[model samples]
Target: MDTRDLGCGYDFEVENSGHVFEVKGLSGDNGGVLFTDKEWSIASEKQEDYHLVLVKECFSNDPVVEVYSNSHRKFNPKKQITTVINVNWSISTSDLNYTEIN
Candidate 1:
């Protein structure tokens, strides 16, 4: 079943096997894959039941999919530090000049 829209952390789930898969698409044959905090957490918790499906050359005519089970143990993932900037501006209506447009 497709569960990506539900934000459950994984993309697809096998009903019979109860296994979850997270898919990553790349334009090139090989590259690094980054998972969100929630996804990483779920992958760690799911253990062998979690699968990381990497789709290579997704944009090309031919794409190849490689499935990795328990990827949390197969490879070490480094933490990616992200900087978030929040900008807020408060403008009073009195500071603005009104122009009439037809």
Candidate 2:
């Protein structure tokens, strides 16, 4: 994996893949930018800048799943975004249960 420093955070690129994952470490009420490509149609609809966190997983034997906070705020169950996991994959969410890492 290759890591690049974005102004507000960092981006991770998985080997041999077109996907680029970005992460922003801003705090409450702050907004930051994430990955952008020509095919990002969702960005075109917005008049203002939007922010997103990027991640990449290339070595998983099964489909990877992710759980993240919504609205770019701190982690909250009411604002969680959980990706559906395929039946062929088994995942453990215990590591990601915390809102912040100390």
Candidate 3:
């Protein structure tokens, strides 16, 4: 089932097998894929239950598909730090309240 929109960390899940998958699509056979902190954490927790599906040359007619179960055993992932900033605007009730409108 497609779960990418749910933000559960994984992209897809196998209904009966109880397997979760994260898919990485690459334009070419040799490329890199980055996982968010949440995704990495989920993968680590799921261990053997988690799977990574790599689609190399994904847009090409002949795409290569590779499935790696227990990705931790197959590859070592690096951690990257990204800075995020949130800007919010707020107004007090008093500011919007006026006794008379001109």
Candidate 4:
């Protein structure tokens, strides 16, 4: 994975898959995720290869993580452009994909 570490929204890139992932987290209360317009645009361009990794209660040891693979499709269920700079997405608990991480 590669860190962006500067301007241009989105966090890291997964080498070789042409897949880039934006990390998002909730406290089990906030209940949703947000992406910047630029970030979503980038993901949109990448289509089914982009990803969103959301963690519930991120500070906890047993946090619940949901991987939105091919986020363009997964996010389609609740994707909405909030403004010129932000895009809001609602994620259903049932839509989560769990990938085993070693």
Give the clashing residue pairs of candidate 1, or none: none
- Residue-wise C-alpha lDDT for candidate 1, range 1-102, written one tens digit per residue: 999899988999999997999999999998998999999999989999999999999999999999999988888988988999999997667555564455
Work out the TM-score per prediction: 0.82, 0.26, 0.80, 0.65
Question: For residues 1-102, could you state the per-residue lDDT of candidate 2 as single tens digits?
Answer: 445543323245455643344454433333433333321332333213322453234234442333242322432212234588767754458756744676
Summarize candidate 3's per-residue lDDT along 2-102 as a digit string, tens digits.
99999998999989887999999999989889988888888888899999999999999999999999876677987778888999998778877954577
Model 4 residue 50 CA deviation in Å: 0.4
TM-score of 2: 0.26
- Give stretches of model 1 more than 4 Å off: 89-102
Query: What Cα-based lDDT does every candidate model obtain?
Result: 0.92, 0.37, 0.90, 0.74
lDDT of 4 by residue, 3-79 (tens): 76765566887678687778998877358677767877877788777788888888877898787777766665455
By lDDT, highest first, what's the ranking?
A: 1, 3, 4, 2
Candidate 1 accuracy as TM-score: 0.82
lDDT of 4 at 50: 78
> By summed lDDT, which 10 consecutive residues of candidate 1 come out lowest?
93-102
What lDDT does candidate 1 reach at residue 73?
86
